[model samples]
Target: MNKEETFIKDLVVLTPDVFEDARGYFFEGYNKNKFSALGIAIDFVQDNQSFSQRGTLRGLHYQNPPYAQTKLVRVLQGEIMDVAVDLRKDSPTYGQHFGIKLTAENKKQLLVPQGFAHGFSVLSETAVVLYKCDQFYNKASEGGIRFDDPTLNIDWGMELKKAIVSEKDLVLPDFANCNSEF
Candidate 1:
């Protein structure tokens, strides 16, 4: 696998070496030693998957410190515009965000370290996303920032007015008002 660092510290994109032939293709999605060599050494304890139709926007979500998670996110069956925002208080890039296109064809994964919020918007008719989290989810620690926060100004690859967002997400706090503990 190859690791590409984003402008934000500790955020990286991983592309695996894919072997293909007339039959099909193969790639090692995860290998502990290979990942460790790349500086990703999280002991992922949970795997989560979500399916969303085009125009659906899911995040800017994270867990507070003491329950913060490091996530390895990838698209399983379609395409999505993945985003991550730095929330680490002491980092120079705190509050900055990074976006990337992840598709089944590209086979690229984003490694979002703890102290960041993560989310995605489906770009295909339908998309299946799989993510590994280093920490078990704690409902009490759940937190989020509004996806359309003016300060963050994320380009979710779609228009917010027409995007399919949940009622819960619709009321999430803006970046500055968010109680981030990372």
Candidate 2:
């Protein structure tokens, strides 16, 4: 049996079985049974995809109680430095963060368990990303910390133009103003 790897509690780095030859390569994007065997029992309820130009950053986002989400996030094309910060006030690892390079070449997925804030920065000419969420989005419960919030000190790929953010996202309260327990 292949040894599974862990990146943090409930977070993992899955190396799919890859088959390669002169015909190029092939690998399963997901194998639910394998994931289950590895102890991830997530039942993905929603799939989301986004395209961003290089230097764009999205998130540091999470939902409040009754709407928290767990995500399996990956890059399909180009590259990105993905990040997730534990926000569960009750979790032992709260306030911690993990960052990883995600690219088409690497084919890695990040498991962002509930109570983590997620974000990423495009590092290639463009990036196409996809994610599976365990819970449906609840607009009213949406919460976020600004990508440049000094307290979080996230280095979102640097001194480039401000990332294009939806107007709604632009108006979210900073961590200083947030009162959510998670």
Best-performing candidate as measured by lDDT: 1
TM-score of each: 0.98, 0.90
- State each candidate's clash count: 0, 0
Model 1: residues >4 Å from true position, as ranges?
Answer: none
How far out, in Å, is residue 118 in model 1? 0.7
Model 1 Cα lDDT, one tens digit per residue, 1-182: 99998889899999999999999999988889999998788798999999999999998899997999999998889999999999998999998999999999999999999999999999999999999999999989999999999999999999889999999999999999998997
Tens-digit per-residue lDDT, 108-127, candidate 2:
88888888888898889999
Best by TM-score: 1
lDDT value, candidate 1, whole model = 0.94
Each candidate's root-mean-square deviation in Å?
Answer: 0.7, 2.1
Rate residue 2 of model 2 by lDDT: 38
Off by over 4 Å in 2: 1-7, 160-162
10 residues in a row with least lDDT, candidate 1: 35-44
RMSD of 1: 0.7
Residue 142's lDDT within candidate 1 is 94
